[model samples]
Target: MIGSLDIAIICIYLLAVLAFGWMFYRKQTDASSFTRGNGRLPVWALSLSVFATFVSSISFLALPGNAFAKDWSSFVFSLSIPITAFLAVRFFVPLYRKINSDSAYAFLEERFGRWARIYASVCYLLTQLARMGAILYLLALPVNSLTGLGLEQIIVITGLLVLLYSTLGGIEAVVYTDAIQGILLISGAFLCLYFILSKIDGGFGGMWQEALQNHKLSLGSFAFDWKSSSFWLILFYGFFINLQNFGADQSYIQRYMSAKSVKDAQKTVWLGGLLYVPVSLLFFLIGTALWVYYFQNPLPEAIPADQVFPHFISTELPVGIKGLLIAAILSAGMSTLSTSVNSSATVLLTDIFKIETANSLRFLRTASAIMAACSIVAALLFLGVDSALDVWWALASIFSGGILGLFLLGLLVKKSAAKLAVSIGLVFVLWTSLSQMFPESPWAFTLHPNFVIIIGTTLIFAVGWLLRKKD
Candidate 1:
């Protein structure tokens, strides 16, 4: 059970973040400050913010859950980041900075047409919605398990607090808060690992031997398999997904713009992507450690895998430490949720409504509120998911898989690629629908759902390249 001291600590952390964010509310006098901070934020802060965005509570909770339930196979996804980060710095950074627009989809309109921009923007919104919803839902799981509080209530309260700060401080507030939150997130993970290690019999060496003995450290099969999540499959998915994130996602594009220069922005990408590699490995280690701990000491009740980590935190940790770790989890969710809300509002104002006036800030706040509400509702809908991490990955793949295709079609093909883009959309829709609806049907698209983006990206680029205008 949670003690008063723990509850007080959590409440104070929440209130402090809100008050800290409010200090920047006055600085958001325009859309640029609210959205990109007019490219004035330091690269270090921006980098940590980007890192926080990459690792949400989905990582904080679900990752440990995933490792506990399975092995370290999925860590390959993080392994793919360095390559994608290199590409982003080499190609995507200069391209977006040159475009110099608040919206990342601006070049799509210039290359293809308005429809292409709308298509990408809508896809981004859907992806963010899914991302936000999953983070919100996952954040609630541990809280509910620990405190016996209603998930819906936890989701709404947490959602609103994130909205308050994000709407008030805008991008500056979001970035700075994320920087602090990122540190807390990492520190909290380290503390958990240290405590877990202390409890183990042989410490690190014992845990390592145990993990290896159980085959829990293997990175999945190296054989070429498309129908299952093989190593190559995860690597491909991670590469394309990171490409979409660094190359095309509004959340990252805004971060790139928030830096002081193109060089700083490139550095942000490098630091953010590289930093996550080790931290994600740490998360996997924590999960594996939890498994060994539980295996050595079986539980009286079989809990959901996703709730195991929280169960540990609640049952095992000291009073104040539990609050601190809970705050870290909340920070993970808030940092990501706040980023999404701000970025979504930016896209809404700049891309959808095209509002850029004195009233732009008002519209952005309203849009942020609306996005928060929708995300909270979406969280409620995703409550019963078997695995929050898997659900998020699947949804992210479906919504964002083809976006990279459209972006590459524009970048690689000089001629008007509108027709090819439209064709890709039609095919993508058909492909996604068939894959999801008839995943097991041999007569239909039966490959692993993760392949959706890989196939879609290749199809769009290949088709557009082959049928390029004979200029």
Candidate 2:
């Protein structure tokens, strides 16, 4: 169990986050500021916010778990970010900026129709809800195990705290807090690495030799198999998913539109993309070190990879440091959760309802609270999930399919027929639903989760183009 000092440290960190969020309360005068910020946040801060949002509690928990259980094949997903960011800055940023709307789905309405806008927005909302739930579950699982708190209790406490601040302060709070949390997340990972190395015999050299001998340093499989996690398959998946993240995801687009200018937004995207690679590598290294540490000093029995890091925290680290690390995990979860609540609310108000009332802020706050509640429910639903990373990727791939497909059809296919676009989108929706529901079915079993987005998006573009030509 964690000591009182550790609990106190965590409480203090939570309070500090609440206080930081409250600082922005006065600035949120309207829906625009509430959802998109003051439009003068520094490019660097926005960049850090982007990094934090992208990394989230999923990365905090899952990356280390991944390294401990598997290899660095997943690192390819992070590697593709820079490539996508470059394409986004060069092409997508200008287009989104030119449209100049708070909702990223606004362009869909103009390009396709109201149905397209609604379709894409609904997909995004579902995706965010699933993501929020998975993130909350991942965060609460370890904390609950470590502290002997009920999972539901942990979910409510953390969910409500994030809800309170996000409802009170809005997007400004989300971004600013994210910037602080981003640094803390990286620092915490670095501290873990340092501690692990200190305990290893002969330091870095010994650790490296151990890792090499055990083949823990393997990058991934290079075979072209679609039924398994091969390098090319992951790379292709990463390329498409990263494109969806930069080009279509609302959390990122909100930051892009919140910047002072298009150029500033573009800079923020590139800078955040560059920063992610090293930070991710650090987390993977920590996992590798954990593998070596345990090899030298084996546990009584094996624990789940996802539980290993938190188990180590509760048993190994001294009090204050353990608290700090716990706080870092909470910071990661809050940064992502708060952003989701605010952005989900933004989408609800702007795209779905089109509310323009005098009490817009009240409506927005209400929406934020409701979204937070829904995310908590979703998180609870995922309590039985085995692998946080796999479940998250599956949910992400399933939800992202229609929206990414629609976006590509709108952006690249000129003179698209509305019926054809809708048809293509429906095909993707049906494909994703069936694939997710019957993963063991022969047709679906061969289509890895990693390739879902790529295949769905490509199918939409290809079919939509052919239909457009016929039209």
Clashes per prediction? 0, 0
Candidate no. 1 TM-score: 0.97
Which stretches of candidate 1 lie above 4 Å from their native place? 439-443
lDDT of 2 by residue, 265-338 (tens): 99999998789888888888888888888888998997888878887887888878888888899888989999
Best candidate per TM-score, number? 1
User: What is candidate 2's CA lDDT for residue 247?
Assistant: 90
Q: Which RMSD values do the candidates have, in order?
A: 1.4, 1.8
lDDT of candidate 1 over 1-471, digit per residue (tens) = 688898999999999999988999899888888999988999889999999998899999999999999999999999989999999999999999999999999999998878888888998999999999999999998788678899999999999998899888999999999999999999999999999988887999999999999999989999989788899999999999999999999999999988999999999999988999999999999999999999898989888888899999988999888998999999999999999999999999988998859799999999999999889998998988899888888888778748888788788788745566557755775676576787687657666778877887787777777778867
Candidate 2 lDDT score at position 64: 86
Regions more than 4 Å wrong, model 2:
432-436, 439-445, 469-471
Alpha carbon deviation, residue 89, candidate 2 (Å) = 0.5
Name the 10 consecutive residues with the lowest summed lDDT in model 2: 462-471
